[model samples]
Target: MNDAIHSSKAPEPVGLYPHARRVGNLLFLSGVGPRQRGSRDIPGVTLNAQGEIVDYDIATQCRSVFDNVRNILEECGSSWERLVDVTVFLTNMKADFKTYNAIYADYFRDNQPARTTVEVLSLPTPIAIELKCIATID
Candidate 1:
């Protein structure tokens, strides 16, 4: 059976899904964006009235996305060291990979988890990046 885990420290899910779910010892995190918890504001993003991205800083968005993921990890009784895999989505891979990779390295450092980064046309929100992770509790 699957169990949902919600973190009060993270932003409310923009969609119907819960923040993360666990099946046995493995926890699967939903795609987490850069939205702030109370304000719902996306850091480093500037959107037009139509909700299209005008300007964005991938570094800022990257940090917030990871922060959200970290919050989920903590709330789920896991830790960064427990992360087994990570999948990252970026709206602009060519333009943003360097900065995002740098910040990511800072976080993971020597305990790097298996990772994949992909470029997408857009996300549900106007943010530049999102992260999904799988971690083990035992």
Candidate 2:
């Protein structure tokens, strides 16, 4: 029942915050972005060299966001199987929701977690997607 922080080898935290925090048996993860470690390059489904939305393509951004989430989960001594809930924030829901759901299904094939998706005017970056979750460490 102690409050502690956890990190994994998937990617380093952008700041002082740990990838997740554990209280009791539950772990709370921060919102995850699509920036891969050591490389400022953001994977794009359609955008060119510049960072742009590129006609609402979501697969690449969705996958990268999930990869970041997976990394954080692994570092926190958890996995997708232990996930209890997730909250997804998107800049454009009308165009990207279906694509995001399709890509998201690839990861949550089992132990489907409770989820909420919301449409937002913008995200931290121009990226189309971001995800945050809660999990249990077994």
Candidate 3:
């Protein structure tokens, strides 16, 4: 049976969807961003009055997004080491890829999951990075 998963410790999803869903032994996580839990602030991001991104630190955002993904996994009876696949979205690939890649290597040094990084025009929020993950769950 499949079950929807929610995490009080993770940031609330910006849309109408659960944080993750478990089917059998696999957990599917929705797109996770760098926003803080219970707050609209995106780490390392500065938004002007127009709600447009003024400046952002890719290193900070990468770490935050990884932590956010880890929180969702652990909250749903999974873990970072259990992750089997990861899909990364970046709004600025040329500008941020190097920094993001370095931080990602630091986080996934022990458990290197299959990853696909893509450049997107934007995201649902004013954040630069997002992650979608899949993990094995007991």
Give me the candidate number with maximum TM-score: 3
TM-score of each: 0.94, 0.83, 0.98
Look at candidate 2 and tell me the lDDT of residue 14: 59
Candidate 3: regions farther than 4 A off: none
As a TM-score, model 3 comes out at 0.98
How big is the positional error of residue 70 in model 1, measured in Å on the Cα after superposition? Answer: 0.6
Minimum summed lDDT over a 10-residue window in model 3 is located at 6-15
How should the candidates be ordered by TM-score, best one leading? 3, 1, 2
lDDT of 3 at 36: 89
**Compared with the true structure, what per-residue lDDT tens digits does model 1 show for residues 45-133?**
88788877788888888888888888889998998889999999988889999999999999999678999999999888778888989
- For candidate 2, lDDT tens digit of each residue in 23-110? 8789998778776776666666455566665654578878888888887888777887899999999988888888888888888887
Q: Which residue runs does candidate 2 get wrong by more than 4 Å?
A: 1-16, 45-56
Q: Which scores better on TM-score, 2 or 3?
A: 3
lDDT score for residue 68 of model 1: 88
Tens digits of per-residue lDDT for model 3, 1-138: 699988898888888999999999999999999998989888999999999999999899998889989999988889999999999999999999999998999999999999999999999999999999999999
Candidate 2 achieves a global lDDT of: 0.78
